[model samples]
Target: MEHSDEWTFADCFHAQKELYRAIISAAVSIRWMIEHDFEVPTDADLRQMEAEVNRELCDAWVEIYVLALREWLDGQ
Candidate 1:
């Protein structure tokens, strides 16, 4: 996956460092959600619980992609 800001990393080392952080944060958030039983809020409550859930999911995905991309870059 392509990072939102390519300028953030000048070399593979930087990418790996950044990705490690992303992975840790994602794992924590996902674990919290799972432990709390994140619920899919209804349309009536889209602005509340549902929106938060969506954000969490998006964050998780970004972290995973970043880590995978970092690994790929490392091999290059």
Candidate 2:
């Protein structure tokens, strides 16, 4: 989504949720790295990983936007 300085309450909550999800994801990755030697993946591997991650994040953002829009429309 495009950046904005103004954030409503629900937007803030969604932002926080996204941040928390990212942190938790990072923590798991870090734990895995600590347990084993991390090796760089091939270009194809990177692309696949990126695609999966992007899809998941997009789904999350869609959910957030849908909820926010629903609430906004309800108020009208």
lDDT of candidate 2 over 1-76, digit per residue (tens): 9886665657755765577468555654565456557766567755655565566566677566766667555654
- Per-residue lDDT, model 2, residue 23, is 59
TM-score of 2: 0.39
lDDT of 2: 0.62
What pairs collide in candidate 2?
none
TM agreement with the true structure for every prediction: 0.34, 0.39
Model 1 earns a TM-score of 0.34
Which 10 consecutive positions of candidate 1 have the poorest summed lDDT? 5-14
What do the candidate models score in CA lDDT, each in turn?
0.57, 0.62
Off by over 4 Å in 1: 1-10, 39-76
Top-scoring candidate (TM-score): 2
Q: What is the lDDT, from 0 to 100, of the residue 17 in candidate 2?
A: 59
